[model samples]
Structure formats: structure tokens, C-alpha cells
Target: MRFDYSEFSGDQGFLSPDELFAPPNLMNFILQYGEQAMDAMANLEDEEEQAFIQQLIDAGLLEESTDEDGNRRLKMSPRLLRGLQHRALLEVFAEMKQGAKEGHSTREPGRTSERSDGTRPYRFGDPIGELDLPGSLQNAARRQVHRAVEEAREAGVEVPRGLRLPIGITPEDFQLHNTEGSADCATVMLIDLSGSMMRYGRFLQAKRVALGMSELIRGRFPLDTLQFVGFSSLAETLHERDLPLVMPKPVSIRDSQVRLRIPLEQAYANQEKIPLHFTNLQLGLRQARQILSRSGAANKQIFIVTDGQPTAHVTTHPATREDMLYLVYPPSDESSELTLREALRCQQRGIRIASFALMEDYWGMDWVGFIEKLTRLTRGTAFYCTSEDLASTVVESYLTGKKSKKFIH
Candidate 1:
């Protein structure tokens, strides 16, 4: 067969390698554009284009899903979502070059047979087979030399041959190699879906980082727990399959200096009439805290990724203690203060928070102080970077800030 090469054309052979659909590019496009990309699929009219999409369905990347109206719609298959997550993880790891190993390390040792870097004095019942022979023998020889010198000196011996101290291994000289420690961790990642996040490519990068974190926990630290919470006017737990379709809620109300409050129950009843552009950090933190309270993991963490400060916060009525949602434009003090208060509550519950602030096209560091203050209040960590560096920054923060849980013996 002769080699065939030509300029790219939409009418070219479908089976040709060059014409074959690339899954990564398609997935990336879908995730980057979110729902809009999926909607675009309905506009294809050519048979070849339809065949191309059919190929994706056949490959198990996309599937026919029904909407609430019982209409057939194209939705991402779980396999595709997993592939994107795995790709994001690989990209982040590639950028980081070297990082922590797969499994989380526990502070307590001697639970497993795998050897770690350090050794400790052997205790009764510790497997003798795991003893560090070199260390044990060294200890025995050192004690022997010290005693031999003392005996020689006491005898006033000036012989060329030096007398040695106690020689040979004893129970006291046995040392065991410290076994590898592994611990499970519960992590909740708060992603900002505020209108501002749709700018500077912030939303896409944050979403990518979240997906990457999911895969990292699932593939490497299987024992660790992971969840993603996207917060706008309210917080909602996101499933892995729906991540690619996620997008920042558009700004429906643009009025300046606005203040509104709705009872939580009423808000749920009129969810479709509610605005979705406000940043509700308070509810997000609370939801995460509540989710983690059920986990028995050794460590718990909350990762916050946002491009702006909280523009809204959830509260309770003073007298009835009824749940309420508050929205304030331009991020009023009431909103920020409430968000910080929620963060303090998280701190009291022993949840570690790491806030990643996206500073692309931002006016000043002053605007970013809310998250910084929240971090300080929680005694957590803060990272500032542009959308371009968000993935690497988040990945590095997660890997380096990991703390092993200590076990009570």
C-alpha cells in the first residue's frame, strides 16, 4: 500500500488515522465549553459528522441520555469522565515532576510489612524477621567496644592488640525496620461557580484540578475519601459523571448595591426563580464540614478554589433560627463576615482548609484578602496564582500539605 497524505478536509476518509476522532481533544473541548459543547451536538446535519459522533458512542465515550422532558440528549459516559480525570492527574503529575507516593502515610508505624525509611528499637511481639540486622549488629558491636576499652584501661594494658567490649547480638540490641504507614483521608473540594469564575479561564482550570484530585484519590489513595462541592447561590454535591458538564451559573441579576434574603425552605421551593451568580462560601464550608463529620478517616480537609470573595452567605433568623439565604451585591461586609464565621466553625471541628485564590485580571491583592483572612482564621493554608498555574499549585499544595494520622496504641 502506498502512503497517502493530503491537506485536512471534512470530506476525507473516515477510517484514515488522520481523520479519526481524537478523544482527548474532544473531551477537553467538551469540558472547557461545558453544556454549550454538548448542545452543539444537536446541530450536526452531515452523515459523516453523525458517523463521527456514533463512533464516540460505540467507543463508550458518550451515550444517549434522556432529559426530564423525555427527550434524547447526548451526555458523557462514566468512562469518558474517568478518562478526563485520569488525564488531568497525569498532566498535573507531569508538571510537578516529582511528588508524594501513591498511598497516604500514617503517623503510626509497624502496621504493615512494607519497609519505610526509618528503623526503631524492637518491641516484644514485633516480627523478628523484619529486624534491621545491620543496625542491630552495629548496636551490639558499639556496646562491646565500649566495655572492652573500659576493661583494657582498668587492667593497665598497653598491648598492641586492643581488647574489644561486648560482642554479638542480644535482645537489647535488636532493632526493627519501621513498617510503612498508610491512612485514609476525607477531602472536600469547594469549587467556585460564581459568575466571575467564568472569566480568565478560571472556571475551566478549577474544574480540571478538581477532576484531577478525584482521580488521584481514587487511583492512588483508594482508602481516602473525596467529594466535590460547587457553590454559587447555594452548594450542591457534584457527581463524577456530571463534572464535565458543570459550568459557572450565569449572572441573572446585575443590579448594583442589592440586598435580598429568602428563607431556606422558600428558596428551595422557588429554586428555578433564584439567582445563581452569588458566591455562597458559607454554605459550601458548612456542607463540606457536615459531609466530613460522617467519615472515620484519620484526616479531613477542605480545598477551596475561587476567583472572587463571597457575595452571599446563609444564615438563620435571630428569633426562630430558621435557615435563610442572603445575597448582597459587591460582596458586602455581612456576607464576608458570615463566610469567615463559617470558616472558624470548620476550624473548631478540626477540618484543614486550603484556599486557592485565582488572581487573573484582578484589581489588587486587597480583594483577595477575604480568602486569606479565612485561611488565617482556620489556621489553614493559602495559595495565590493565575488560572494558568492553578492545576500545578493545587496539586503541589495537596501533595506537600498531607499530614498522616496518628494511631493510639
Candidate 2:
């Protein structure tokens, strides 16, 4: 999963968390000496977490300063925040692997999913998706003029406001698209929150990618929509702000104790609520299919972010005596029933499925096979990204695929 960091530093000129910050951990330094820091630090020893805070500052992810008392402290940089926001946008519709191949209809007179043809006469019961806005307006105006003239003659009097044509569209007056047809496209993001995600320290990264993708779709594709599906035992929709916030570094014993008691520990870890399970790949895919169906788009797609072999399918599933003993450290499954169903469902709807595996170890040959099948079944792509280049790799893959779908000259 290791990647060459240099590959991410070229002309794209996008800033990283490091380039924008002051030298080091401003917050920890501040907490040690400052009086105004938040109460979250009450249980935290000032010097104990200094290194962690410093890492944030050195990475350019945070800014530091002291108040009148001259204490050390930190805050998130505006640049980093804006950059994260942009990343979120990129995540949603980074790239389309394919574009509409079908013809468009103009008769319906509104925006259609595909490329539009020229306009046509008004018709009754045409779909609004194909409506031709400009032509429809013109028809309304034309009808008004004709109605005025006819009324004047029939009434045998100069046309007054009542007799004059006040444009009104009847069933016969409605125009529709002349082209063939079109359909809207949709996508669903499946995030894995099994314990392995925590073990490999990728749970937070997955959340960021998920949020970014959702933001991208919301901003760019007015016609397209994205649904967030977090799967561990089962799948549930998550709000964008609820993404996980796992730190990039390790924690100490005292910190660990605090982490364990937090009412919603996962939420605190990632600064967002994330699902937890024992690597239930099957449950996740089943949830994804249900979510995709709700999108109601003409096309659907699924993206999976995971780092381990799926173990149990449900958080509450019963384990045998031997299996219970194994639960202390479960082996990666050689095959996954969930992945099989995921592939089938995606393929049935022409939905693409992509994977981003962010583990140092491949987990096992079985997991690799599952990843391969997931990609092949839906004809999507996959990437193995380590710590240094995970986000960049995802952005690259997304934008590249999107570019491929554009009708470039």
C-alpha cells in the first residue's frame, strides 16, 4: 500500500496539510500554559499529548498562537479547511467512467438525463424531464397571439382583456422532447467501519473520502445524488458532518482510557459518528444495494473503502464455542457471501463498484480475490494506498475516471 509521495507533489499545486502550517503542535503547547483552552483538556496532561498536537501544527493543518499570557495554542488554518471542503467536492463525482450513450428527447420540454435533441410541438403527458424551456415559452406566447385574433373575430368586437389571448397551456398545447430518452445517474458510497479499520488506522481516512465524495456530487451534478451507507453489522445512512475523525498518530495509555469511556467513542475518535462491526462485508453490501435502489436514478454506482477481510456478517450474530474463542483474533475469511451479492446486485443495475484498500498488509489472498471480483463484476477499478498517499490516490482515480467519460475533442 505504500506510495511514492513525490508523485503527488507536481503542478496540480493543491496544498497539503503540512505546507500551510507553522512549525509544530500549537494546541498542546498552549494547553500546557494557556487559560482559555476548552475543558476537553481537563483530563489530558499538558505535556503528555504535546507531540500529538505538534504533529497537527507541523502538518500545516493547524495554526498556533499565544494570548496576552503568552501561552502556546493552535487552531485549524482557513486554508486547510477550504482545502478539505474542496476535497469533499471532488469526492462526490470525481469522475464518471461512462457518459450517456442514449439519444435525448426534446418533446418532454424539460431537462432530460441524456444529451438533448431539438424541440418539438407541445404534447399531452410528456415527461417534464425532457421539457424545452425556451421553446415552451415561445409556444405559450404564440398561442396567446393567435387566441387574441380568433376571439376578436368571433366576438365581432375589438379584443378586450377578457377576449384577448391570455396564454394558458392545455393538454394539447404541451410540447415534449423530440429525442429518444434519458435517465438520471446516481451513486452510493459504502464505508467499512469494522475493527480492522481501527487496527490499521484507516477508519477516519475512509470517512473523509466518503464525505468528500458526497460533497462533490452535491456541488457538481445537480441531477445526480449520493447516499452515505456505513456497513459493519448493518448499513445505515450517515450525515456528512458525522464522518469519523481518527487521528493520524497513535495514542498513549491515559489517552486510551479516556477514549474507551467516551459515551460515543467512535464519534470522538473521528470527530464524527462511525459504525463499528467485526468486518461484516455481506451486511455492508446488502445495505448498499438497498440504498442505491432508493436513489431512483437511471444509473447507479458503489464505492467501497476497506482494509481487511470480512469476518462476521452481523454484530449480533451468534458464535460457536470455538468461534467465540477465535473472536479474540479472527482470521480473514477466504471468501465473502456479501461480496458475491454486492457484485451481483451492482451488475444487475449496471452499477460500477470500485475499491480502495488502505492496509499495509493485503490481509490475505482471499481478501485480494474479493477485491478483484468486486471490481470485475461491476467493471470498476481498484487502488491500494498506504498512509502517505491515500487521499491523493483516491482523487487521482476519481478525476481520471471522470475525465475518461467526458466527450473530449
Candidate 3:
């Protein structure tokens, strides 16, 4: 059941020795291609590679089965999935190590004046006193030289020998010394489990982000709390132990008709029969608020990772026996307003809402407006990014929020 380290120590055709052992790459491939990952492995001509695949099966890392159509498929075992989550967390830690050093201090501008060895692009409102004069000047010089070269190329004029460009010290060229600080914080990651997220593979990306953030908080800020909430037709709190096992349900044409007829509670009760397919953002925010209300941390923040507009909300009606719950769809203005109200409530509670709009460009103006307003109302930030950058973006946002005292109420 154990993997032979020596077999993977040597190169195997298209994959290098290191890649064969890299859990993140292997997990990503399997998540994206499913059975194809195993098929590719099985197709390998090398006996060592074949044995390696067999070991994965023997170790319960992978399960080979047939679908309803009798086609062979490979599924990742729970143990292997958990290992992948750990691997993803490690990758984030590795990225943090390569970036700025971690430590604790007051992020207030006037409270702490000491500067670290690192420098970052100067942000508006950063105290001028914190500026790194030498680094800023160098940045300005580089910009000026690049501009001069472009001007010469446009004019069809050869650069004069020994030409010296004057350094322009614009604010845009300023650089500030990086600072590190820490604060007690409670963060809830609201992941969109709607059909669209699964359709585009964004759900998997978000899952990895959650795992990475969980690890970051657990390792770096031991006292801080990080909660994960997944929202589709309804919002549910997910424990860290169950995170690796979560999978998005595929959306079929009949999903819309079937999900709308069922109550949210009933759907949840029969989750295996009726999978979540609609985006219920309002429910997610409400749950986040409830979770954060119990936390004593000075800083409370909500990080939303979504790929589409809010398309559903919860409503109740009195029935003959009891009150019935329903999921309202088409993302009406009421739903949008309710979602905003929840965000405003969070703000009033001193909770900052930072949203990462994955695939925003592909979803059009409605998605853009929703995310922009959510962040603006809460006085938080919004980032539009691709799936490839989601993990790094989530980690950076969390770290920045922790270091900056402004996010604290």
C-alpha cells in the first residue's frame, strides 16, 4: 500500500521525478480530468510507472470503477483527497515564505514607525515618512529610462550616446518599506457552490483557497478563527475535517425546475437527492454574521469567492402543516437588496467584506456591479482574478487584512 519512493525518484517520460511526487500537481490533474488522470497513468509503458499506479490503487489513494454507462472511471479516495488539501496548504505557506517575513506589530500608521527590510509599491494615504527614499528614486529612474526608450522609438530617432534621463519622482513611482503586524481576527470564507462555479472548475479552486487560508490562520495566528461556509440553495457551515470531501454537484437542465419546487430545509435534508445548484448569497452572509457574532476577536472579516451573480435567496410561507421554505431565484432586485442589507449589517457589526470575483469578466456587468457594491458598502476591497491566481490572492488578502489595523473595528 506504500508508494515506492525510488520509482518516482527517476524521470518518467513527460513527467519529471519531482513532478511525479508533487501532490498539488497530481491532485489538480485528477480533479480536473477525473478518470483520465488514471487512464494516462495506466497507458504509461514503463513498468515502474505501472506499478506506481497500482500502488496508488492498493493504498486506497484511488478507486477504479465503472459508471452507469459501463465506462471505467477513477475517483480519488478520501485519504488522498485529504493529502491534497494538506499539499495545497503547504504550497501557500511556501509562497508566504518566499514573500515577506511574518511577525506581529500594530499596523496603525502612527502607532509603529519601525520599517522592515522589504519594500512594496506605495499606497495612497501611506505616511510619506515611511517611504524608502533610495528605493523610490530607483523606481522613478527605471520608469524614466523606460519612457525615454519608448519616446525615442516612436520618434524614429536613435538614442544619443551617453544620454541621461532625468529621474521623475512622481507619487506613482514611490515605494514604501513593508511592515508586518498581527491582530486577533475571525474570518469566514463564503464559497459559492452554485452550478456555475462547478461548470467552470472554479469550485475546486475555491476549495483549495479555503484549505490554504485555514492552514495559514492555524499556523501563523493560533488564536485567530477561520470558518468556512458553503452557499448554493442554502448556506451550511463546513468543518475543516469535511472540507476535503466536499464536491460540487453538476447542473443539469432539469435542476432549475427541481430545485425551485423544493424547500431549502427539505433540500438540505435530502442533499444527496437534490444537490445545491443555485447561488444563495444572502443566506451565506447571514450565516457568516451569526458565526462571527460569537467571536471575541478584534477583527472580523468575510472573504467571498464567487464566479456568478447572486441567483437565489430564502423565503418562508405558512402551509397547512407548518411553515414552508422556498428558494427564490432569477436574482431579483429584492434578493440583491437583501444581500446588500446583510453586508451592511456586517459593516455595522464592524465586519469587513473582501470579495474575490473569480471569472468576473466572463459573467458580465451584473456580477461586477454586485461584487463592487458588496465591497464598497462594507468598506472592504474587491479583486477580479483568474482561477490560477485565486489561492495566492486569497492568502495575500488574508495576510494584508491581518497586518492592517484599519480592518479592525
Candidate 4:
């Protein structure tokens, strides 16, 4: 987007014209993940890379200042990440439309309907369209007419001044129009925590995916919510704060570190193991259904990150004798049948399930066949990703994917 040079003509101070528009996107990413971006920038010592960085700084996309050593360092600004860019875009678009249709009725879109549902109480700066007509007219008449009658003799003016248009709408006369807003969306993320995930570094992969996806959602979709669930022997939900530290302990801390030792001792003493049901695909699907069933958003989606032979039960109710069992005596009934059952469940609930799997381990590699079957049955896509790019792959796909309709039970 080009910055309007004319808008900077009368500016009295520091910021240049290019700087005004450049800040939004730059500020957004910075506010979303501050130190991460700065640290990433630190590693780029090439002149071309530095120049590219400066372009962003000049555009006001980045916040830059001199360090104690007098060297310039770059960082992202927070305002851009908080929907300011979107809001500014909306405002500019509205202004453009208004300018194009100037002199036409300023009637708002979807207004003129009789429903009082849109009526909002008066506020200090609201425009005149927002006024309660009866109250405003009553106040105006009392001031323009009744006051004239009561004060005419004292003012020494003619008994009635021919009709007056009560000096154009005053600041107090402006009334704001009220409108209803749509509800926010709620999302649930399910990650595979089966034994196989440990083999291919899939667990750590899922952690990165969770962190990046959360940041993305929190930034672009401010009104939406996200929940993370990891399932293995059983499903355990994760909190946002837990994502960054999910992997190995900080290697810098020595075993002799007193501070770390104290905490470790306490944590281990009180550590409670969350329930883990066998990689029961059936149980996870059933639980996910129950979770999505209660969400109040207009839409919902489920993302499963895993690499395992789904071994859970299938039916919503007790198993019947005829419900075929394929494995016995140290049974390995790792059939695709149960996966099909879960896919059907997701479909029935109008839930879209996107699965991310890895095939790096002897046992985990079987996940390829299982994920293929499930993705096809659920009408959701499957991804085969490397550990490094797993998070990016999943997040990119989700943010750009078509939004699906909410399934009603």
C-alpha cells in the first residue's frame, strides 16, 4: 500500500510520510512476538539483509532505537498486532465509500428496519442519527419555542421571532447510531500424544505447531478462542503458557543448581499423572464430539496432530458381540476400521478434522496409512511434515483454509 504523500504536507514533527503506513504490519508482528523477531534479526549480518531491514524501519513498520553502545537495533511495535491494521483498513474503506457517495443519504447499511434491537443509549460524541427523536425534538422545541415565550419580555424582542432553524445541530445534538455485532468463534486443537510421537520427535513438533498457531490466532483472529488437547493413553488439555516449555529442560541449568533442584524435588513429590486411556481412537473422538457439541460459536474445527496406530475403542455405546475385533493374544488389531469410525463421528457432528502425521519411526510410520484413511473419510486434509517445518505447515494451511459451517447435534 502506497502512503499518501499529501497527508504529510502539514505535519509539524518527526515521522515522515512513508513511516505512517509502514508501521502497521511491522508493529503487528513485533507485538505478537517481540524478542523472537529481534533475536532472529540479530543473526542476519549480510548487507542486503540489513538494507531490507532498514526499508521496513523507514516505512515505520519496525520500531528502532540506538542501544547503549549507540548501535541501531530493530524490534516490532505492538499496535500493529492488536487489530489496528484491520481497523485502519476498515476505517479507510468506509471513508472512501463515504467520499464517493457524498451528498447521498448517509443511511447506514442494514439500517431503516423497524427493529429496536439496534437502538443504543446516547453517548457524549455520538452523531445526530443516534438521537432518540422524540426526546431530542422535545428538548429542541422547549428551548427554541417555549424559552422564547418565557423570556421574550425580558429580552425585549418581538413576542415571536419567525420560525428559526435552531442554530445547526450542536455538539450535544450529535447522536450515534447503534448496531449489533457478530459473536466470536471458538476453536479446539487436538494433538496426538501416542507412544509413536516420542520416536520421531513428533511431540516437540506438535508443541511448536501449538505455539505458532496460538500466536497466529491470537493476533489475526482476536475474537476467536483456542483450546489445546493432547491425547495418548488419554487426552490432556494444555494451557498457552505451557507451550514454550513443553520440550527438554533448559540444558544450561546444571543438576547441582540449587534453585532448580528445589523446584524439581517439590514438583516430583506432588506430581500427579493425568489419566491416559490407551491410544483409544474411539475415546478421543467421543470426547472431542462432546467438547465441540457444547461450544457456542457459529463454527468450530478440530485439528489432530499425531503419528500412531490408533488403538482406541469405536462405538458411542457399549460394544456388541458382532462389533468385529481384529487382534487377539497380545492383539495388534491396528486396523483402519476404528479410524473410519472416528471420521464418521466427526462428519456426523459437522466437525472438520485436519490431521498432521509423521512417518519417521517403525511404529509411527503406520500413522501414514491410518491418517490417509481418516482424512479421506472425514473429508479433511492430511499433512506429512518434517520436524522443523511441521508447525509452519499446519498453521499456514489452517489460516488460509476455507471456513466450514458449524455442525449441529
Candidates in order have lDDT scores of: 0.79, 0.52, 0.71, 0.52
lDDT (tens digit, per residue) of candidate 4 on 1-409: 2244555556567765334444444433432344565656655789998887877655555567778987667654442322333333333333231223211111343233222344444566444454667655545565567666878878888788654665433444433345422334566777765544555566655665565566656666666677877655344566665443333211221232111111222332442432132354554565677777888765667777665666444332245323321211121443357657766887777787776665555443645666667776788777765554466556555654533322111
Sorted by TM-score, highest first, which candidate order results? 1, 3, 2, 4
lDDT of 3 by residue, 1-409 (tens): 3545455534555654334333556777765654456668656779897787777778677777787978666666666756666677767666543564354445553313356667778777777877889988888877777878888899999864443756558998898877644467888999887777765567777777877777666677888899999888778898876565566546644533332556656766887775467778888999999999999997888988888777676555556443233444555676677788888999999998888887635536466788777777777788877766778777876665442212110
Regions more than 4 Å wrong, model 2: 1-183, 199-201, 244-277, 314-335, 362-366, 396-409
Q: Residue 159 lDDT in model 1?
A: 32
Residues 289-372 of candidate 1 have per-residue lDDT tens digits of 999999898789998888788888888789999999988887788888988998898889888998888876546557677876
lDDT of 2 by residue, 198-249 (tens): 5544664565565566555556455767676665533456654434232212
lDDT (C-alpha) at residue 231 in model 3: 88
Off by over 4 Å in 4: 1-185, 245-278, 314-336, 362-366, 402-409
Q: What is the lDDT of residue 402 in candidate 3?
A: 41
TM-score of each: 0.81, 0.48, 0.62, 0.44
Best by lDDT: 1
